[model samples]
Target: MQKLVSEMDNMVLRGEIPQAVAKFFSNSAHTKDVDGSETATKEEAIQKLTGFVGAIAKVNEISLLNSSVGQDVSMSEFRFHFQMEDGSEINWHEVIRRKWKDGQVIDETYFQN
Candidate 1:
């Protein structure tokens, strides 16, 4: 699970969020954002991630600050800096917690710092 979480985080850092979602999320996966918005399935999650990535004009940096993995759960802390298409900047820290089942993420929640 640790390796899996690391790989997924790497993929996201590289702006391969859609691919990461496809590879790591279960078909019935659910995702909740820090804002309390939710995605009920893997397809929705992929679309949401893709849209967010698309809005980024450039990725300044994406750093994995910390991480931990337990039996079926993983948490990763990340810092993101990005330039948006509208010339706005987004710099924030967030922690992603995922619940895994059958080697795929069934639930994911994002907490903003």
Candidate 2:
């Protein structure tokens, strides 16, 4: 379960949406990008993330900082660094909380710094 979050982050950062949808999320998965955002369905989640990938110039790294697992849930903190089209860089420090069911994530939320 703990590794799932890391795998999903890599997939998103690398624009591997098909694999991410197939391996990381369940059919009814719900994902919230940040606070106050509506939880999205599997397809919506994929589209949202794919859009993000297209908007970025390059992904420098997705560094996992910490992780913990407890009873069907996994939490991970990661720093995502990427460059914009204009050559500006941004680093996002965020925590992902995921609920797993039958080896797939059914719910996920990202809290950012």
Candidate 3:
């Protein structure tokens, strides 16, 4: 599980978010905000991730703050620091819980505050 997460982290750092997202998410995967305000199906998630990856100028760093793996779900807390076209730095912090099945993520909830 840690190895998979590391691969995704590296993919993001290399600006390969679409590939990363696709590699771990199932065809019917669903991702939603923790508050249930926003949700993305597998297709939507791919589209959104493409846009996000295309918009990134450079990935400055990825920090794995913590993580825990349960029977069928895993919670990961992490931070992404990146640069925009104008050379501005941004830090995004979030905790994401993912339910896994058949070695792929079937459901994910993102927590941001």
Candidate 4:
């Protein structure tokens, strides 16, 4: 599980979010965002991730700050520094909790700091 999460994080850091979602998320996967918005399916999750990645002008930095794996659950903390296409800069820390099944993420939730 640790290796799986590490691979997914590396993909995201490399701006391969859509590919990561396609590879790591289960067909019935769902996700919840910090704003309380939720996605009900893997397709929705993919679209959401693609849209987010599309808005990034450049990735200044992205790094994994911490991570832990336990049974069927894993948590990863990430720091993101980026500039948006609209000229806005974003630098924030976020934690993602994932519930896994059959080596794929079935559920994910994000908490931003």
Look at candidate 1 and tell me the lDDT of residue 10.
Answer: 92
lDDT of 4 by residue, 35-93 (tens): 89999889999998899999999999898899899999999899999999999998989
Q: Which regions in candidate 2 have their CA more than 4 angstroms from the true location? A: 2-18, 86-88
Candidate 4 weakest ten by summed lDDT: 9-18
**Could you tell me every candidate's TM-score relative to the true structure?**
0.96, 0.79, 0.77, 0.95
Candidate numbers, best TM-score first, in rank order: 1, 4, 2, 3
Clashing pairs counted in every model: 0, 0, 0, 0
State which candidate has the highest TM-score: 1
Specify the highest-lDDT model's number. Answer: 1
Candidate 2 on 33-92: residue-level lDDT in tens? Answer: 775665467777777766776777987887777878898988878888989887788789
Which stretches of candidate 4 lie above 4 Å from their native place? Answer: none
Backbone clash total, candidate 2: 0
Give the 10-residue window scoring lowest on summed lDDT in candidate 1. Answer: 9-18
C-alpha lDDT (0 to 100) for residue 90 of candidate 2: 76
Root-mean-square deviation of candidate 4: 1.0
1 or 3, greater by lDDT: 1
- Candidate 3 residue-wise lDDT, 58-85, digit = tens: 8777767787888778887878887877
